[model samples]
Target: MTSRHHNLQHLKNQAYQDPLTGLPNRRSLGDYLQTALDRLHRHAGQAVVMFCDLNRFKEMNDTYGHTVGDRLLVAITKRLQAALRPDDVLVRFAGDEFVVVLEQCGSRQQALAMAHRLKKQVGSTLHVDTAVLQPRISIGIAMTSDPLTAAADLLHQADLAMYRAKRQKGDSVEIYDPVLDD
Candidate 1:
């Protein structure tokens, strides 16, 4: 590749990737969601959008400091990645928040099962320097077979569900229901 081409690629990566965890950043999520939604429109299958937030992460960060907190986020990212399929897009949406878009998911049951697997993988104990922490997560899932559903709307549903899960229990999964908005 030409030097200019390499530089452009590097810039794109920096723009789309989260520096702390090397996961796709929120900017990448918008593009990936559009593509995933398009693929779902052509194919007859359900796509799942999961909003995952780490429970008590703020307390951990405050207690340990950013260095340890950053390491913990990186560790959590690896575990979540390992539990997901290659086709899935995982984005580091914000601090202690991640968005996972699963394309071609078979059903709501499959999405729920995947959410359980993610919770299990991320709940494992971690040792970052002197801090031994047990990380937990709350996942909110929104599944859609309708091609008309906007990506932002779907993500908003999942975010609402996540807040419900966080309120009901610290580390749990909640599937989005229309009633959640009410």
Candidate 2:
């Protein structure tokens, strides 16, 4: 590719990717989710958003330091990427938090199943330097077949469900229910 084209691609990656984990950042998530929602409107498929937050992540950072915490986050990102399908979108939403968008998911049950797999994969023990860590994540999932649903609404619902899961003890997955909003 031309150097100018390469520079443009580089700029795009910097804009969209998390520096520590190389996962897509929140800006990319917004674009990808909106596109998925639009496609769902035209077709007969569902899209799922999973909000995942690391449990007791602050404790880890306080105890181990940010460098170690950064390493752990990068390791966790790799595990999560491995567990997801090739087409799934994984975004590093913020510190100790990530979002996964599954497009063309068949049903809520399928989304739930995917969430379970993610929880298991991330919960596995790992060694970063001398510190041994067993990471746990609370996952909240929201699935929609409705084309009229706004991407932000879906993300908000999933985030709400994730908070509910975190309250129940870490490392669990909860599906967003409409009742949860009330």
lDDT of 2 at 93: 99
Candidate 1 lDDT tens digits, 59-85: 999999999999999999999999999
Give candidate 2 misplaced runs (Cα > 4 Å).
1-5
Residue-level lDDT tens digits of model 2 in 1-182 = 69999999999999999999998899888898998888886788798899999999999999999999999999999999999999899999999999999988998778888998998999888999889999999999998998788999999999999999999987899999899989
Name every residue pair that clashes in candidate 1. Answer: none
Instruction: Please identify model 1 stretches exceeding 4 Å from their true place.
Output: none
TM-score: model 2 vs. ground truth: 0.94
Q: What is the TM-score of each predicted model, taking all chains together?
A: 0.96, 0.94
Which pairs clash in the backbone of model 2?
none
Error of 1 at 160 (Å): 0.4
Candidate 1 CA-lDDT value: 0.93
What is the C-alpha local distance difference test score of each model? 0.93, 0.92
